[model samples]
Target chain A: MIHFNDVTKIYNSNVKAIENMNFTVEEGELVIMLGPSGCGKTTLLRMVNQLESITKGDIMLNGKSVWHSNKIEMRRNIGYVIQSNGLFPNMNIEDNAMIVPNLLGWDRKKMRDRFNMLMELVGLNPDEYRKRYPHELSGGQQQRVGVARALAADPPVMLMDEPFGALDPIIRTHLQEEFLQIQKELKKTILFVSHDIDEAVKMADKIALLKGGKMMQYAEPARMLNKPANSFVAEFVGQDRVLKSMSLYTVRDLANALTLKPVIESPDSQNINENLSLRVAISKILNQEADQLIVENDNGTRKGSITLDLIEQFLHREIKESV
Target chain B: MCSGGDLIVNLIEYFVSNFTFILGYTWDHIKLVGLAIIIAIVIGVPLGIYCSVNKYAASTILQIASIMMTIPSLALFGIMIPVLSLINEGIGTLPAIIALVLYSQLPIIRNTYTAINNVDPDIRDAANGIGLTTFQRLIKVELPNAMPLIMAGIRTATVLNIGVGAIATLIGAGGLGGIIYQGILRTNNTMILAGAIAVAVLALIADLFLRLIENLFTPKGVKK
Candidate 1:
């Protein structure tokens, strides 16, 4: 667990890079720092690892002040992944992944086993990539290696600064889903930085929205979208927030909250799984020009039919109850 | 005035008759160039790394090295002679090696500085982020990434030193340059050609040898 107790950052004795910030990242949770560029989100994330110094207050890791911990040892225990992957060009995939383990004096065989396990976790074949240099891999592949390297020591805390910012949209989305899957099993307390609202909405268990070094809101993605702390967050999350909020609710969620319409056999109706988000359901309804989409369960049983009107009622109820 | 064909014949005759004499001078030339390059690397590489970390030192040391290169080699050697005379080692191998070492400094140091400085900033971030101590990062990441360029600097110094080392003969340090000097004194074009060819050949061989070493030391991940 990481706690920020009235943290602030001042640059050159005058410029305030971050204001009095207080937050907590609970164990096994992912908190995303979402803000515009120069909002000090990066600064806040870096301060946890001592990459950036604090001017005031204290940051505590597991009830211990980070300032009092040995910088190298402290950093080794916190996994860090950055944009551009940061894979050492001088090391092959396995060696790069094994950096922290090797430094911690893990035995060679254990490091090898850890490397293979991490590679598999990140969806790479350990043996096939063990000998390959970073340059030999594609950008997406290299990012996977970067993630594998960060998890090598299995640190309980990981900090990611736009880790998927460099990839194209398709690859970026793919990696995000894969990372979410990884997070489910590992449950590392993560503080991730991103400027994209959709990514924050999709992945963040909670979003810490910032503006000009001030926290605009720190709440769950659903709350932030449903009831923005202020106009700044509303604008930042964008005017299409209702549409954006649709992604947070699955067709199953709409069905559970409000009875979806009974299926009326229409040739134009599209078939969508109940596991898919209401965002997909809405899009299918509009794109296919059908009155509804037949939502099916994993076992291929008809759960219900989801229409655009049903999603609207569901969103309204969700907002009212959360308030 | 000898014809080109006659000069070739004379050169072959000189080679056949004075093979051992040529071999001894070649050995002397190799020794001088080799020693100077090794010493320059020892001094320059560390200095370059130091400069990369400290801004003031980088400017001061890089300026001094560049200025050192601008000095005429003969004049530099002449200056070294007087400077070393205080220790009573005015001429011969001492002054020659000192001058050669000074002449070789700029390329070695400058390349080292650039190489270390240019190691992608992102990689440095990753190294630090991953908890590599300063020393560990240098040894494991920075130095390995900096190897090819540092070796290039050494190669530049080596080749440059070989050509300049021939001038050591003027300071009473015997080398292939002595043969050329003798040829000049006797107006023997064939002897001059023999010495020039031997020096050029030595430079080529040394460069090739250093290239092999560079390849061996370069991390395979960065080969391309």
Candidate 2:
């Protein structure tokens, strides 16, 4: 677990990059720091790695103060990937990937095993790419090498500063999906920074919306979209809250909103779950051939009926309130 | 007093008769220039890398070397003569080698410093983030990236050394330059041209050879 306690960073000249920030991330969670450029998202991420010193307060990793630790040792244990895919120009793909392991003095065979595994994980075949230099690879491939290099030592935590920000949209989307898949398998705690809200929404298990170096909201993607904490978050999340909200709901949530009849004999016996938002329930009723949805308890027993009229009244009230 | 045809015939006759001597003289000129450059590289490259890594020390050393470079070669040799005479009476190849080495240090030092310093900061940060020790980063990344630039400096130093090495013949250094100096004293233009041409050819050949080596060793992605 990583914990930030009243952390603040003031530059030597008195500019505050971040101030009075406190947050904690559970083990194996993907927490994104989302903000516009220069909003201190990058600075906050750097603080975890001790790349930027804290002006006040402390950051602890697994109950040890990061400030008191040896910086090189701390850095070795934390994987950091940046926007430019900072693979050394002189090193070939395999050597770049094996950097940290080599530093820790892993023997030749162990290093080779780790390098090959990481290359395979990042979708680079060792035989084809091992000897190729940085410039020989494409931008996306270089980023993969950057990510592979970071994971070489298998650090429990990763700090990514817009690692995919430079790639084209198509490649970026593919990489994002791949990243999520990798996260699921590896379960490494990650603090990702990105100015793109949609990416934040897609990739983060939890998103922290930042503005002016202050966190406006920090919540799960569903809650952030359904109820933004402030105007800044709402605007940053943009005008398509409904569309963005869809990403928050899986097919399971949509399935739960469907109206089902308890008995085929009675037309009004069909009902929607009252717990579901009226707009979603009404859409389910209209879309499905069923007349109503039957609400159920946690044990799968029927709780009550949600009539079409009730759903209509609920939708009307919600629309009026939103307007 | 010789006609143009007579001069041409004389040149061909001279070349045919003295082929062995000319070849031997050319070999001696190459040896002198090549050895001086090797010595300069052996001393200068590491100094350049060291200076680049240690800014304060590098600046002080560079300042001293720059000052040394300002002294004229002839004046430097003249100054060295009295000091060197105490060690060994006659001025010879030693003074010339020492002067050329001093002259060649600047380009190698300056270029190496700039090359290592100019590597992208992001790349350095990446290496650091990945847990590369300072020494590992220097050996594996910084030096390799800095190669082409360092090589360029080395090439400049080498050619410059060869040119200066010829002038060393003025101080009892036996090479093609001795031929030139002797020809001048004797008013023989043929000998002067022979020595001048030999020195120029040596410089060209060394430059080409080093260039080939540079291309062979430099990482493909690195800009030359």
The DockQ leader among the candidates is: 1
List DockQ, one per candidate, in order.
0.90, 0.56
C-alpha positional error of residue A4 in candidate 2 after TM-score superposition, expressed in Å? 1.7
- The residue-by-residue lDDT of candidate 1 on A113-139, one tens digit each, is 999899999999999999999999999
TM-score of chain B of each: 0.98, 0.91
Candidate 2 wrongly placed segments (more than 4 Å): A258-323, B1-9, B54-60, B86-90, B220-224
What TM-score against the true fold does each predicted structure earn? 0.98, 0.84
DockQ of 1: 0.90
**How well does candidate 1 score on lDDT at residue B143?**
93
Candidate 1 colliding pairs: none
Please report, in order, the local distance difference test score of every candidate based on alpha carbons: 0.92, 0.80
Best-performing candidate as measured by lDDT: 1
In Å, residue A107's CA in model 1 sits off its true spot by 0.7
